[model samples]
Target: MSEVERPARGVSDLGELLATMRPELDPDAWVFATAAEPLAGAEVTVVEAEGVTSVLRKHDLPTAGDAPARMRVSPPFARITLQVHSDLEAVGLTAAVATALAAEGIPANVVAGFFHDHIFVPWPRASDALASVRALQRDAARAGDARG
Candidate 1:
């Protein structure tokens, strides 16, 4: 059997990272909920002193009639995953993304995984957020081109 080779490290150059980042938005509505136990199908989960917080699709949630009385859920959000495999040590990427979104008055909740960064924004502003992110990438790419 052959072993698959992985890149020694993800892209760390800010310019390259931004120039190549491809943001893909998930169409489903996701929400942050706090429950006593972790949700079975949660995409992200964190255990805190208060309770377990999970980010999962709204459709995965149980109907109100069958819901737990103690579950606390937040407003629906849209998940935008940056397709670029960014290095863990990469700097400025989060700041740049946050700045771009903040300029348009969108609140971003960023989560960094081993290889990529995910941004969650209000569901209503998903399109706007996507445009802003794409613009950031476009501008960076143009700058890189000019430099070359």
Candidate 2:
């Protein structure tokens, strides 16, 4: 009898895979603060400014603040953010991570920036989603080691 070979699962060398995957970023990249107290409705616009600002605009979003020096956001799923290295581009990493999360039954929106990649996921599933990302990284590392 002939033995069937199983296909490789998971990504290896997340960084390198990410380098090759070429993921794309969503156009609109921002998430309203759903965790803050009182839950003021504010359209959190990640402006390229110095500090957080309470813009009294006609919007329900409670906190309108400026993102840090190097930050990004994913749309729709507004509760999670994927803090990344400043030097990295947003598209590749964000897309790879989003695809991985989707495979795990977790939906995510990715936003790209000049520095890092951000992911917004449902608040309830944020932790699990993050774990999935860590797993991706680990698998990548393992695969990279094997290649070397």
Candidate 3:
């Protein structure tokens, strides 16, 4: 279908969103940092009262000599982007995913974009986090089937 024919708002049904969200883990290592301004290759940036928070690949950061004098960098992370096109107003998606990861003793950093929801978890726990999310999707699908 053409873009014009597509639904203006992506999937809004919570069950459908959960059941169909195909989480894909990215291959690159990422980091969260606070800088005076977003660096050259940030994938996402949020401006807050404290400063600009940038999410970028680890390799994208500048060397110490070229970097900002006072940037604070977080631990390495791995990103997993949900393939499902979720509506901005959709509820429960983030909570459900986060809860699942939390149960596995993993911390989830979720970022909602216009097209997808991106999740960042500790680099060492990326695979486990992905598996947890996929299991949640499977359970949701089974529940949806039962409802049908």
For candidate 2, the 10 contiguous residues with the lowest summed lDDT are: 66-75
Candidate that scores best on TM-score: 3
Query: Regarding TM-score, does 2 or 3 come out ahead?
Result: 3
What tens-digit string does per-residue lDDT give for candidate 3 at 1-148? 6575555798989999999999999999999999899887998999999999999999999889989968999999999999999999998999999999999999999999988999999999999999999999999999999999
For model 1 the local lDDT of residue 135 reads 100
RMSD of 2: 16.1
By lDDT rank, best first, the candidates go 3, 1, 2
Each model's backbone clash number? 0, 10, 0
| Per-residue lDDT of 35 in model 2 | 30
lDDT of each: 0.95, 0.49, 0.95
Model 1 CA lDDT for position 120: 96
Q: Which lDDT tens digits does candidate 2 get at residues 39-96?
A: 3333333343453432212234433473333222223343344443434322256566
**Over 4 Å off, model 3:** 1-7
Residue 5, candidate 1: how far off, in angstroms? 9.8
Clashes of 2: 10
Candidate 1 lDDT by residue in tens digits, 1-148: 9998865799999999999999999989999999898886798999999999999999998778876669999999999999999999999999999999999999999989889999999999999999999999999999999999
By summed lDDT, the worst window of 10 consecutive residues in model 1 runs over: 60-69
